[model samples]
Target: MSAMLEVVGLDTCYGRTQVLWDIGFSVAEGRTVALIGSNGAGKTTVLNTICGILRPRKGQVIFEGKPITDIPAHHLVGMGLVQVPEGRELFSRMTVMENLELAAYARRDGAVDKDIRGVLERFPVLGKRRLQISGTLSGGEQQMLAIARGLIARPRLLLLDEPSWGLAPMVIDAVFDTIKAIQAEGTTILLVEQNATQALAVADEAYVLEHGRIVLGGTAESVAMNDEVTRVYLGGFNPRGQ
Candidate 1:
């Protein structure tokens, strides 16, 4: 399969303070790739650069082989690069239905209405709270709504930043399970997650970023088993204990 998304020597900055440094990765069509690292490791920065939230200083970001590093973030959604940012940043005052509708502003899917209903059907709890204030929903529901909002965009590559943050174990499981289901349905995923254990479980391939650069890259199994990962990333948890 051809690369659905590619980043080469990507570098970003916030008013002259450079953040990312020569970062690069590739996501094949319908594949799931995780950019795993702790805080300030340029994981989220990579997602921002890919989705056009932040323009790179010098590098190439190609989506379906078209350079899009200069595209506007709002317009990038139309290009099928949808990012579900951290914190499930939903319109708390808006109803769940409204949040989902807002996500489809750029797409003209023939079954848009049907698709909304399908989302509700698949997530019955969300359906039950369809008219409720999104901000009032439980943390898990809010996270689900965020993911559902992105799916409504009919994205080709879903860029998720720290999806499992501040979530309960059960909720994190739900999120990762949903991630796998999305991949099964042919949506390429670029995930930046802190939960290495779960992220490695769902990812086809994973990259480890540290101090604004990609230091280690490999398959999920390879990452989970690495000595560096075990010593620093795993936090000394025995597999049998888990």
Candidate 2:
């Protein structure tokens, strides 16, 4: 499969403090790629740069065979490169329906309402609370809404950052299940996650990031078997039990 998104030789900084160093990876069309790392490992920085929230000081972001390193965030959304950022970034006062509608702002199609209904139906909890303020929802519900909002944008490549952050284990399971369902529907995904076990389980390919650089890259099965990954990320629980 051809790459849907590529980050080649990426370098990003917040002022003079560089957060990413020659970071590179690619998400293939119709595949789920996981970028797993500890917090402060520049995982979110990578997503921000790809989605145009942060400008890379060097390197290129290629999407759909075009260089989009200079495109603004809003324009990228219209181009079908969407990010469900960390912290769920929902409009605090907006109703669930309102948040979903606002996500389709860049879209010029009449199907926004229809898409909203479809998304709400997929996330039935959100459907039941369609009129509720987003901030009032629980953490898992807010995460669902955040992803639902991203889906309403009709993304070709979805950059998911920490989808399971701060949720119960059961909720995390549900969230990963949702990720699998999204991939099964043929949407390409680039997942940046701290939950290595879950991320690798759901990903077809995986890269391990340490201190802002990619330290490992392979099929998710291989990454899961790495000693360091098992010790640090998987809590010494080897999936292979070797």
Candidate 3:
């Protein structure tokens, strides 16, 4: 499979303070890749840089084999690269349907309404609450809505930042289930999650980021079995059930 998204020698910063250093990885077409690390490990920064929310001081971001390192966030959205941020940044004042509609603002295709219906069917809870205010939904519902919104954009590579954050265990399971369903439908994903166990469970490839650099990269199974990853991220939980 070809690389759908590639980050080469990335260095990102907040003003004078650098947060990511020489970061590199690739998400292959139709595959899910996970980036796992502790808080402040610069995982989200990687996503932001790829989605064009932040300009990298050095390095290149290639999407579908094209250079998009300096592209603006909105333009990247139209080019089929979209990020579902960590915080579930919904339009708090808007209804579920309204928020979903706004996600397609960059899309010129006339299938917005059709896509909306499709996402609603995929997430039936959101379908029942279409008219309800997004802010009023439960934490899990909000996360679902966020993912659903990203899907509305028809992204070729989806950047998901902490999809399981702040949700109950069952809710986290549900979210992962949705992620698997989405991947099965052929949307390539680059997942950034502190929840290493779940992330490794669904990902084909895994990269471990530590203190702003990639400390390990390999198949998910190998990463899960590494001593440091098992101790620090997975809490000794064996993903392969050995």
Candidate 4:
């Protein structure tokens, strides 16, 4: 598959506090690539830079062969690059269906309606609760709403940050299954996750970032089995977790 998104030497900051230091990674067409690290290791910052919430003071962000390093966030959305941030940010007062409708506003074409229908159909729970306010839903449902909302934009490359956060094992499993389903439908994904085991399980390739730098990368299995990773991210090489 061809490359859909690429970042070279990305450096991002917050005010005077520099967070990301010379980071770079890519997601190929139809592939799931994961960036896994402990909290505050710049995982979220990486997503922010890719989504244009934080502009990189250095380096390039190329999506679909177009340079979009400093482009406005809205323009990036129009280019089929959409992000589902951590914490499942949703319109609390809006119904599930209404929140999904917000994604259609960025469409450059007519697929938004179809995408909405597809998301609702894929997530019947959301369909059943379409009229229910997002804030009233359970944490799992809220996460679903967040992903569904991003899908409404018909994104070619979807950026997800810590998608499994604050959910039980069962709900996390459900979210992982949903992510796999979406990947099967040809959506390239850039995932940032703290759960190293699950991240390696679902991703085709993986990158390990430490202190805002790409420390290691390979087929998911390689990084998952790496000694350093087992020690830091997975707790020793005992193989208790798969």
Prediction 2 TM-score vs. true: 0.97
The per-residue C-alpha lDDT of model 1 at residue 232 equals: 78
Candidate 3 lDDT over residue span 1-242, tens digit each: 76888899999999999999999988889999999999999999999999999999999999999999878999998889989999999999999999999897778889999999999999999999999999999999999999999999988999999999999999999999999999999999999999999999999999999999999999999999899889888888978764
The runs of at least 3 residues in candidate 1 whose Cα sits more than 4 Å from the true structure, single-residue gaps closed, are 237-242
Q: Model 3: how far is 67 from its true place, Å?
A: 0.6
Tens digits of lDDT, candidate 1, 1-242: 77988899988998999989999889999788988898878787788888888889999899998999878988888878899998889999999999988877667767788889989997899999999999999888999999999999888889988888988999988888888889889898989988887777788889999999999998777777788886777785522222
Q: Pull out the clashing pairs in model 3.
A: none
Error of 3 at 52 (Å): 0.5
Please tell me which model should have the higher TM-score, number 3 or number 4: 3
Question: Model 1 Cα displacement at 54 (Å)?
Answer: 0.5
Q: For residues 1-242, what per-residue lDDT tens digits would candidate 2 score against the true structure?
A: 67888889999999999989999888889999999999899999999999998999999999999999999999999999989999999998999999998998879999988999899899999999999999999999999999999999999999999999999999999999899999999999999899888888888899998998999999888999998999999999865444
State the lDDT of candidate 4 residue by residue for 1-242, as single tens digits. 55899898998888888888888777899999999998889998998888888888899988989888879888888788999999988999999988988768766677777888889998999999999989999999999999998888878999999889999999999999999998999899998999887788889999998888899998888888888898898767523345
Give all TM-scores, in the order shown: 0.95, 0.97, 0.98, 0.94
* Model 3 ranges off by over 4 Å: none
Clashing pairs in 4: none
Q: List the residue pairs that clash in candidate 1.
A: none
Candidates 1 and 2, the one with greater TM-score? 2
lDDT of 4: 0.88
